[model samples]
Target chain A: MWRGVTGTARMCCLESLTYSACTRTIWSWRSTIREFVTLNVGRFKMPAKEVSS
Target chain B: MNRKQTSISTCFSYERSLEDLFPLISSAGFTHVSLGAKEPHSSYLSVSRRGDLLQLLHDANLRMDSIHGIRLDLPGALSSLTATAEAAAFLDVPVIVVHASSFDFDPSEFDERLEVVLNTCEALAPVAEDTGVRFALENVLPGPATELVRSALERLPSEHFGFCYDSSHDQIGGPKPFTLLDVLGTRLLALHLSDRIRDHVDHVVPGEGFIDWEKLCEEIRHSAYAGPVSLEVLMNFSGFKDQVEFLRQACRQAERLYPLVFGENAAGL
Candidate 1:
């Protein structure tokens, strides 16, 4: 996914990328990046089957 | 030189009754307060209400430092602004904090609005002189308000007109942060010291958010404002439901800030 995106958005699109180097470079924007990830992933979670039946 | 005084805006008491605000601040250890256009203080905006206003302040054992005049009621703010000066005089408040325009205004109408503000203030010059109250136009946001403030300061006389620097607004609303202090160093008569967060969450306690208090303290210390560190802080979003506790926290932060700005003496010599 990061192969296409660029800049902070590219850096923000990863799952295993809480690296110190990334944090150091993007210190001012890491919180927003984290929130973006949290919201995007949280929005697509699937419900358990038969839970309401 | 003396220790810088501390005062909080009455916006924190919007939920409480008008009469209770004075005593509340006094009990919370705040000796002075800046009146706001909050619901509690809405009806008390006149010279006719002077007697009641005085009795309230007198009974509370607190004095008014300033009044946060109309921030957005436009097209007819002349009367309110004039009455605010009258009220300030009656209360012996030295300054009246005002906005350049409403919080949300059209960018296209900048000049028109600016002209309106200037004309209204031009009309208030006589009232300001008569009441001996200085109208301090506060910096609201970075764009037009900033420009308006600069123009107003340049055009108006420093005797009856001045500038107010709000810390949160300076931090968030800017072409660049904290440049107004350097740009216009004169007539800094009032302050709205508060903190700000990224999502436009402002008026939080001084230390609760991301404002650099030490830097701000140093800035003001080097400036010409030798008056109260008047905090235009609010409590609705500060997580403190108890107003007294909120005031205490603000006062404690202010105590720490005073030394940073003025050293151990509480005033720069």
Candidate 2:
């Protein structure tokens, strides 16, 4: 029973690590995509458009 | 010789009319102001109202040294240019600082877009010259906009065309900010002094952010620019007094560092 408990604990720890790694990767990509959009496409609209509209 | 005068942008408090803000600026010991060509306060669309604004400035004992030109894309750009030039002429302002471009074109369309911008500048250059005003194209970031302006300056070769270097934009604009002063040299007509923290374009007070004002002062002193360092800081009413004092101190620090960085003769001390 002790051995089984130790095995389950190890599995839970690995799952937690994987979850955090995935979260970090997603956040990194989110920031990159935001910057890419801003630099490559966001500035096309004129400031006047926002003012006039 | 007297030290180069310091000016502040009206963008600091756009909600406040010239009558309300000019006194505050004068009280802060700023004799010169750069009028922002936007809504509610100093609108280029309401160029006819410039007479009243001029009266307010005159009453406040402040001078409108320059204008931050309106940003409009083609079809409307030429008309806006005319209005801005007219306003500048009416106010007797010498420089009308404008953005090179506001659009984000694809890398594939870079050359074509640049050609369009250059042609537009070419068409507007003569208008600026006729009105006794200089078109100082301000640098923006995340692309080759500055280089494009440089090319436009080369192709046009007009005395009316010049550059307005923005420190905050340059901080995020890939290249080192001071290097731009070296590149533009005598073509530099005006400055938009602000600070940025890392990739964020904060426009915070000079020393509060990551900008090295000492080094930038040295670069400006070494360069051919002798104009007022105008602050294009973001608006914050509660801390307005602190911001004014901060800019005053920054200008004083630049003045003190000028001789140290460039020596007596170069600094004209």
Candidate 3:
């Protein structure tokens, strides 16, 4: 019973570490994509009203 | 180029006092004047006597369309600009034209220097707005300086900030005159129309130089700008009469070309 409890605790720790790392990688990619889109698309897309005004 | 829509800069007669220049412009058949804020005529600095100046202009039958801000002491640029704005407000002038940078500016420190200028303009933008005047930055040499001004305008993004298209400077500078007009578009608030020969800023008669006036008119017609096409020539061709005739003829040509460029009965005019 003691051995089983220790094994389960080690598995949970590994899973938690992998989950955190994957989340961070996904967020980093998301931010990069957001920046690229904003720079490329947003630059030419200044509101027409702004130009007229 | 209706005489009613035309203006002449007093910088052409910078040696004369405003008191003297007003009568000359009025006598020349020009109803509007672009007041110069330079020495001998640094009248814009006399903030307390603004009323007297206005009365003098009124007596001469000349209206102030704009104020040409002078560049003297580099450190005093902001103060001069603020005073000019005040003068513009008091006189009910709609625009104030300013030089892009000082004559003594170091090209090596262009960006850094431009940043400082931009900061000054940003600080003064609110004052301009409060006084119901627009600050139009005129293009000076090295060509790329205008791009710097455009960047500053973009960053500030105020209705009080715009571009003053100086034809002679644009011709001397790298960009084609019409291209600068196109780039400026609706941001164009004032004009310093003069002609140039090659790199020389001759400020000669309009059609007598390298600038293609027809193309300029076309570009202006396409743009939303509808303001005075003010002449800023420094030299009189022969005498004051000849110079006035030359400007009057140029205005006629511009008026004739307007319909050709923008089609008949364009509403914006």
Candidate 4:
């Protein structure tokens, strides 16, 4: 299961990889980016056991 | 020159029985009379009972003009006003004359005491007003007599409240060469008329002392106040006959100047 997941992610990265070194510039794409992170995690400890009589 | 107006106050000639003194005072031609409601330094001739006093004034055909209560400096000063009003109402008197409380007249102390006096008047004015009697504060303390009276009038601005302008007290404890006409001209409700000599020692006849009775009458007329000018001289020391003579003379002087000094129909003058 881990091998297949890692192989697909490596193929996607190899397919999109590119290097530009020519003096002529390619079409330059400008993009504005905004970022936010949401988190939801909770934990509650058990109430102490009642003392036995 | 205005004719002087005079009335009589029963002090020295006041005896155990008003019946004993009524004839003498009425015979002396006194149309108005004042009763010393309190005991003088020492005198069994007390008019402590109010009913007897009322009957006496009614029988004599004399108007009970004022009831003089002394010892303002004593504890319970307000009680004295109450007692005085009680006696005055019993006698159907329209006015009551009181002296400045002999308590320390220090500006600060006077301010404190005056507050108490004003509070006293606040409680007493309605009582007097209801009975149709007025409380006239007379000046005797050694301060600006007019200012003292002014402070009092300012404190209690009621018609039932006024001043009994005492010339003798003014000459003695108050400002020298005192003329109430200049200071409390209109607020003068009555006159505690007596002559003063050398620091309030002798209650002499009107003209006997340095006080200008002529000027006093002139001011009273000018002020347009028609209150009684009750002569408050002691008869015991002067001899009843001499006192009567002085009183008669005062009346004569008053009548001679009444029309001129006081307008015609001087109802209470």
DockQ of all models, two decimals each: 0.01, 0.03, 0.01, 0.00
Better of 1 and 2 by DockQ: 2
lDDT (C-alpha, whole model) for all candidates: 0.73, 0.69, 0.68, 0.61
Per-residue lDDT tens digits of candidate 4, residues B129-238?
Answer: 66778877776644643356668876676588887776665665433555555666677777767665554344555655666667766777676366566676654323
Best by DockQ: 2
Shift of residue B111 alpha carbon in model 4, Å: 1.8
Cα deviation of B34, candidate 3, in Å: 0.2
List the candidates' TM-scores in order.
Answer: 0.77, 0.72, 0.71, 0.69
Better of 1 and 4 by TM-score: 1
The deviation in Å at residue B99 for candidate 4 is 2.3
Error of 1 at B32 (Å): 0.7
Worst 10 residues of 2 chain B by lDDT: B235-244
Q: Which stretches of candidate 3 lie above 4 Å from their native place?
A: A1-53, B1-3, B37-39, B71-73, B103-107, B173-177, B236-269
lDDT of 3 by residue, A1-53 (tens): 99999999999999999999999999999999989998899566654310000
What tens digits encode model 3's per-residue C-alpha lDDT throughout B1-269? 43445567776666667777677667766667887646346456676678888898889887777887764126877877787788788888999887766533455866886778777887787888789898887766634566666766677665878888777767664336467777786788887776665444356656666777778877876776667556776564412245456556655544454464456665323
Instruction: Select the stronger candidate by lDDT from 2 and 4.
Output: 2
- In candidate 1, what are the lDDT values of residues B1-269, reduced to their tens digit? 44345778887667676587777777766667877755235465755677887888899877788887775237668887787788788789889888877654567877787777778878889998899999888776667767877886788888888888887777773224566887765678888888775445778888888887777777787787866767878775686768778888887776677677656665522
lDDT computed for candidate 3: 0.68
RMSD of each: 14.7, 10.6, 19.3, 30.3
Write candidate 2's Cα lDDT for B100-147 as tens digits: 666344567658767777777777877877898888877776366656
What is the alpha-carbon RMSD of candidate 1 to the true structure? 14.7
